[model samples]
Target: MKALVLAGGSGTRLRPITHTSAKQLVPVANKPVLFFGLEAIAECGIQDVGIIVGETAAEIMAAVGDGSAHGLRVTYIQQEQPLGLAHAVLIARDFLGDDDFVMYLGDNFIVGGIGGQVADFTASRPAAQILLTHVPNPCDFGVAELDEAGRVIALEEKPAKPKSDFALVGVYLFSAAVHEAVRAVQPSWRGELEITDAIQWLIDQGQDVRSTVIDGYWKDTGNVTDMLEVNRSVLETVEPVVLGEVDTDSELVGRVSVGEGARISGSRIVGPVMIGDGTEVTGSYVGPSTSIGDDCVIRDSEIEFSIVLPHSSILGVRRIEASLIGRRVEVTPCLRVPATHRLVLGDHSKVQISS
Candidate 1:
C-alpha cells in the first residue's frame, strides 16, 4: 500500500509564523513535525509516497526534496488550495490508483508510531480504518459513533453536539473501495470535501468501517499552543548528547542534546532541551523542554518550554516561556521610556498619588 501525506494547510491559527513558513515544517524537538510522520510511514515499509501541498508548495518541496533523505520516493501532488482532506484524495487519485493507502496529516503528532495500525490493516485489509482517541472537546474534531460491538456506525465532521467523545485521529487507512466513496460524497456546508463525509458514505453503503480507540498521546499541532506542547512532549524522549563546545563556566543538566558547532558559555542548561547545530547560548538559563533551532542566539535571556526557530535571536529579554518564535526573528529588550499611568478622572472618581 502507498502513503498519502497531507502537507497543505494555510495554518491560519499559527498566524505570523505560518505567514512565513508552512505549519507542517514547524520543528518539534529540532525536527520538522512532518518529518516525524514521514518517518512513521517509512517504518511501516511503505516506499512510494505522495505528499499533497498547497500555497507553501515551494517551501515544502525545498525542504523535502526527492524524499531520498527520508528513505522514500516522494511524489509531490499540488492541490492549488486546501479544499479539504477528501479533496486531497480526489486530486491524488492517479498517484494512489488501485492501491490501498494510508492518509496522514503532516502536522499531527502521535506518540506511538502507526506501525501497529498499519500492520493490522495490512492483515485484515479493512474497507476503511480510522484511529480514534477520546477527547474532551469533540466538537473541535471529526467524531465517530460506534456500535455496541465496537464497530464504527457513523462519523461527523466537527459536530455541534457529538454523539461520542472519540475524535478521529489524523492517521487513516483506506482500501481501494474509498476511491468510489470519495467520488460519491458531496461537499459539506463548509464548501469543502471533508474526509469524514467520505467515510460516512462508506458506512451508509454497509462497507466495513473500523475504528481503533488509542489512549496514546496524540496532538494536532495547528496552533501555537499545541505546537509548544508537542515540542515539550517530543523533548521528553531526547537522549542527552553534547556534540558541541561548552565552556568551563557552563553547566549541562539532564537530557540535553547540544548539536555540532553549538557553544554554550556561562549558562546553565536544564535537561531535555535541544540546541540545534551552530546555536549559541551564553549567560542565559536554557530551561527544560526548549528546542533552539540552528544558528539561533540566546544571550542574557531566560527561556523555558519555548521553541526558537532557526536564526532567531533573543537578547536581553529577562524571561520568556511557552512561546513559538519564528525563523530569523529578532527579539530584543524594549528601550523605551519608563512606565507611567495615564487615566482620566471621572466625576465621582477617587484618586491617590504615590509620594
Candidate 2:
C-alpha cells in the first residue's frame, strides 16, 4: 500500500502567518506539523508516497524534496485549485493506482501515531476506514451518525444540527474501492467535492465502511488557538535534556530541553520548556509550555505558554503569553511615557476596540 498525504489548502484561519508560509509547515515543538505525518507514514513501511500540494507548491517542494530523508520516495501531485478532499483523490488516481492507500491530512496532529490503525486496516481490509473522535463542536467538522449497532449509517459535512459528537479525524484508510466512490459523488452545496460525501456514497452503496473511535489525543491544527493547544499538549511530554550552556547565574527548574549552542545566562527557566539550538536567553523568565525556536533571542522578557518561531527576538518586553510569533519577527519595548490612561488616536481599515 502507498500513502497519499494532503498538504494543500489555503490556511486563512492562520492569517498573516499563512499568508507567507504553508499551514502544514507550522512548527509544533520546533518541528513542522507535516513532518510528523510523513514520519508516521514512513514508520508504517510505506515508501511510495504522493503528496497533494496547492498554490504554495513550491514552498512544500522546497521543504520536502525526494522524501528520501524520511525513507520514502515522494511524488508531488499539484492541484491547481483545492476543489475538495475527494478532488485530491480524483487527481491522484494514477499515483495511487490499484493499491490501497492511507490519506493523511498534513496539519492534523494525532498522538500515539497511526501504527495500530494501519495494522488494523491491513487485517480487516475494509473498503474505507475513518478515525473518529468526540469533539465539543461537531458542526465545525464532518460528523458521522451511528446506528443502534454503532455502525456509521449516515455522514454529513459540517451539519447545522449534528446527529453525533463524533468528528472525523484527519487520517483515513481506503482501498481501490474509493476510486469508484469518488466518481459517484457530485460536488456539495459548497461547490467542493468533500471526502465526507465520497465516504457517504460508499455507505449508501453497502460498501464496507468502518470507523475507529480514537480515545487518545487528536487535534486538527487549523487555526491559531488549536495550534497553540497542540503545542502545549506536545510539550507536556518533553523530556528534560540540557546540552547547551547555562551560566551559574541562571537557574533551571523542572523539565526543560536546552539544545546545543543555546546559552542561558542570568535567567530562570522553568520547564516543560524548549530552548532551541543557537538561541540565547538572558535575564528572562521562560515559563512552562513554551517553545522557543532555533536561533532566537529572548532578552529581558517574560514569556509563558507561547510559541516563538525561528530567528525571532523579544527584547525588553515585560510579558508575553498565549501568543504565536512568526519567524524573523521583532518585538521590542515601546518608547512612551507611562500613564494610567493615555489618549491614543488611530486610523484603520477595520477596527474593533473594547474600552
Model 2, 1-355: lDDT tens per residue? 9999999999888877787789999888898999999999999989999999998899999999999999999999999998999999999999999999999999999888999999999999999999999999999999999888889999999999999999999999999999998998899999999999999999988999999999999999998788888988888999999999999999999889999999999999998899999999999999888999999999987888888888888777766777778887777666552222111111111111111
**What residue pairs are clashing in model 2?**
none
lDDT of 1 by residue, 1-355 (tens): 9999999989888876777789899888989999999999999899999999999999999999999999999999999977899999999999999999999999999998999999999999989999999999999999999989999989999999999999999999999999998899888999899999999999999998898888899999998789889999999999999999999999999999999999999999998899999999999999998999999898987888888888888776766777777777766666442233222111122333221
Model 2 stretches astray by more than 4 angstroms: 335-355
Q: What are the candidates' C-alpha RMSDs?
A: 7.0, 4.3
Question: What do the candidate models score in CA lDDT, each in turn?
Answer: 0.89, 0.89
Q: Which 10-residue window of candidate 1 scores lowest in summed lDDT?
A: 341-350
For all candidates, the clash counts are: 0, 0
Error of 1 at 262 (Å): 0.9
